[model samples]
Target: MKLIGIILLFVTSMQAQNFELRVQAKTVIPGKKIYLEYITDLGKVIKIDSAVPSAQHTVNFKGQVKDQGAFYLLNFFDTPKPQKVLVILEGGEFIDIVADGVNDEDGKGNFTMKGDYPNVKYMLELMAISKEMETKVRKWNQEIQLDQKQEKRIQAEFTQAQTASTAKIKALIPQMGSHLVALWATNFLPAEKEMTSLVEIADRLGKARPAHPQVRQFVANLQRLQGVNEGALAPEINLATPEGPTLALSSLRGKYVLIDFWASWCGPCRRENPNVVKTYAAYKDKGFEIFGVSLDQNREAWLKAIESDKLVWKHVSDLQYWNSAGAQAYQVNSIPQTFLVDPAGRIIAKGLRGTALDQYLAKLFESK
Candidate 1:
């Protein structure tokens, strides 16, 4: 009787300790087949389930007691490769993601109370700061609507909020600094065009946490990005074209080159191609050229965009969106971004658009 009681107790404990997860998704378009792909360790992909005609479906999984690591949920919509959605099963109370189509490749959403990690407190605090900053920004925008004087005042306030947020991030650097710094340093600082300041911050962080993996990676990525910034020598690129011909970026030396980072399906990039065409045509005679590096996984779409845009320039891509070798080399996180390199192969301008591109090129030609 004693042995039987002990066995029953063990069985009850096992049942209570089991963990489970369920995912439900609704596709935006009807008849568009949607599925969930669960990526596991060692690059294995486990298909969860397919959406039914009702627009919603679910997938369930039981957590293993011995397995301890992060699991990601990817959304597939008629694409071979999956887009990452939820970073589920991580031990955290809340996870703040920047969302899809909002300045990041991964969709932004927050998970509350999902983990037991101590560093989660820092994440929560950062989320609070982000919320506060959003509120301030909204208020400032409202003031900007009032008057010209109010607009200037609001700009100052916005800058102050940004500064405060930066400070908060700096203070949190010592504890949960690695991931935080990487996220911010990669996304924010460059967008703000604070390259010099970002370099200093990255360098300092790199030295302070020499052994930290994320910090080291961030430092390396930032350094590479900074090397391609304005007034820095452009990084060399050597890739094979679809026609089995080898080409090198250095071969285009002694001419002004506009290194255009774009994707085939990128709407913004497609819209901006007309301006690029105008700029290229106006400046090509003045030794200007464009080397388009497409972040496109499909060769057909890539060629279609180039031909449709009447883009008569050198095009190169490994046909890997986001994971292209050139994308990694250039640290291109966003599309429709162009680097204007001088005749000496040094970057002189970036993100030039419309009249800005025209004016800058006019000046460059006039100087020549």
Candidate 2:
């Protein structure tokens, strides 16, 4: 459930174990508060503990943790500026931390752990490197937008940076002793390229850290990955058309169907509609069709986008924004996503957009 107070809880009830948190913050005022929060498996942020600093400019939190291997956050808004520090926490670990309350220009502090907190240290280091890599990649993206001619070099720099970061992260996996941190670290790398390592890490941790949320999440992600593999049968999407008629994705079985997920409010989808329309016009006669699923709250806007974009494809929606049945069936996290399915309802490729979409259609139509 959603949590609003300091007594919120999460999953996996285990034997209660004492967790000692020692914090030193010179910046926190004497009368203010510091909240210790933990995230639930449902992505809910809950406050588990709160403290008011005494005379020593320090706060000590002693509580019984009911879950093991979950992430915890220490949030401080009492100071002139806010501060937050993340720690990979467990049930029995007593974490001793030092916070000076004055971080660098970027608000990133030099948080250091006192005792043997290997997993936490490894996680923090990985996060620091990941942030640097993200900054570099963002620059590459900005450059690519302005200068498409140098896109190849800018893109190469991004890939090379990702490769280096992945290599460094992989080297620390075995050294972290427990696969708990390693499992969480995989989020920094591209999931497609790191699938093998992901499976190996998950298998190793599933036996040891079965109660961990990260381990459980890894297992669930792996299952979804298997279900949505390139050749797996595309998950069924049956929703209501605008005219109060039910439309099922399986009905478009015997053709090359692009299951396009979009919305009227999405700018990227509107921008990309012309490409989709062009491709459909070129390939509509050659056994190709598009099944448009919209995540829109208003039926009028949905109809407007279809007519404004001049989309001559089959369209359907349940008038539910972000909670549409079709969006959930396809596990769409963002708008303008597309999946190309073959005649027998097997997904051939995914994420084909813009010129890439045109090139794919050209190859498909020319092969015959």
Off by over 4 Å in 1: 1-21, 27-56, 61-71, 77-89, 93-185, 188-192, 196-215
Tell me the tens digit of each residue's lDDT in model 1 across 1-368.
Answer: 99999999988766554445444333233454445455543324566655532434434445432222233454534454334454433222223322221112423333342334434455556667766876776566556457647754665666677787877765665454433323333343333255665666677667766654445565776667766768888888777665657677889999988888888787558756876887888888889898888888888888888888898989888887776788778877667778888878888998776566788889878977
- The sequence of per-residue lDDT tens digits that candidate 2 reaches over residues 61-146 is 87666455677778774454457787666665677887765566655555666656676778877987887875885576577669
- Look at candidate 1 and tell me the lDDT of residue 331: 74
Model 2 global lDDT (CA atoms, 0 to 1): 0.75
Global lDDT for candidate 1? 0.62
Runs of candidate 2 with Cα error greater than 4 angstroms are 1-17, 24-32, 52-58, 76-84, 91-115, 211-214, 237-345, 350-368
Candidate whose TM-score is highest: 2
Candidate 2 residue pairs in backbone clash: none
**Collision pairs in model 1:** 91-115, 92-114, 92-115, 93-113, 98-108, 99-107, 99-108, 100-107, 100-108
The residue-level lDDT of candidate 2 at 207 comes to 81
